[model samples]
Target: MTLTLVTGGTGHLGRDIVDRLVGDGHHVRLLARSPGARPDVEWAVGDLATGVGLSDALQDVDTVINAATYSPIARRGGVRPVDFFRSPSAVDVEGTERLLSLCQRQSIRHFLHVSIVGLDDATLPYARVKLAGERLVRASALSWSVVRAMPFYYLLDKMITSFAWLPLWPMPTTSFNPVDTSDVADHIVACAFDGIFGERTEIGGPQDISIAELGGQYRDARGLHRKILPVPMSEAKARGMGFVISRGARGRLTWADWLQHRYSVTHQAA
Candidate 1:
């Protein structure tokens, strides 16, 4: 059995990845901040900020999948201290660095770092740190692959349901190639098990849509009759208020997202 270690194994994407790995019969070890009732998973209690239990978590593991993020979405409208970005860097970047170092020491076979598509030149601190984490993974002595994915449907689900009673869905004009979390999880698991390394793959939905259009789809999917309101604003303004408002606001559309959308729509139109 392949002993696979998963960081942030309790999160939205992380949980899905864990479930898939466990279903596939891999000996799974999960790094979580708190202990919970995941009976099948070997839980290692550790806070990424403090680096607790990381070494124990990495012990005897053959591969690692990092699916953790310290974004405001995880906090759900609470005021994150300035250290929110710094702390994630410590965990997401520096913590991954530590894990890779340990992997080298243990001769762990593979490392998979989960990153976002626009992080290469993204202005958001979170995306930038994710990019740094990707860099650390690539530069490490251990063999690795970076999976850069687009925004997940969970963001859309949360937006529609959280404000279900609202008259209108307010979103920016920013576009995205939103992907299903399940597909992203499946792809990551496949990469981990197959020892695929040395390149990053940009995974997204089969189609792309503008935030306004995405809002409309979410509303329709949930059978809610809400107007999709697109607010025209500069990127800086959208990002600033988006941090306090919609998760869609903070995301800058990557060339990949843009081109993917263009190609998909053109194909559909033809």
Candidate 2:
């Protein structure tokens, strides 16, 4: 039996990965900030940033699915790019470096990393750091598969909320194939089990929707009659957001489907 260790198993996508791997009968270990319990998950208290409690978590681990990240860029206000947890350089890049070093010593076979799509044309400080992290993983001796995912629908919710106080939603002209987090999780699980390494797979949603159109859909979904204002951006900046989908497992769920099903249900409950 293959023993798989999942970093950040407590996270949104991490938990789903844990369930998927365990359901497929893979022995799963979770690297968490503190010890926790689930039916099949073995918990190893560890810190990705500081490299503490790593050995205990990685002992005899065969494969690793690194899902850990520190992304606070959505509502970036008065934040310095390199200041502590506010930037991916501190948590994403450094933590991935620490985890990769551990995975190397443990002689881990496959390292499946979760990364965002626009890492190469990264305009944001976090995206650049994430790309840096990917470079490190690729440069390492461990066999690896990187899945570059699109902007999650949940992030769109934040984008809508941030403009809630304003009369008009100043939506970015940049487009995105906003995907369901679950779909991304499933793809990661597939990569983990398929034993395919040294491949970078990019996954995204069904249709490309500009931020303005997405905001319009969101406004309609939430019963908000707010005007959708398309905020024009520089071509260079639009290119940097990296929304164009080249290829991979396309998501079955659309933005409208997600809004009607997930967002509306959650928002109504709130």
Considering every candidate listed, which one attains the maximal lDDT? 2
Best by TM-score: 2
Q: How close is candidate 2 to the true structure, as a TM-score?
A: 0.90
Model 2 CA deviation exceeding 4 Å by range? 74-88, 266-270
Mind giving the per-residue lDDT tens digits that candidate 1 earns over 1-270?
Answer: 768888878888898899999899888988888888979989888866677788888888888888877776445632345633443577777777777777788888888888776664455567677777888888888888888777676665564456657887777786556766677788788877774687756677665457777766555544556777797667665443322121222224442443344345443310
Evaluated against the true structure, the overall lDDT of model 1 is 0.70
| lDDT on C-alpha atoms for all candidate structures | 0.70, 0.79
C-alpha displacement of 42 in model 1, angstroms? 1.3
Native-referenced Cα lDDT, model 2: 0.79
TM-score of each: 0.77, 0.90
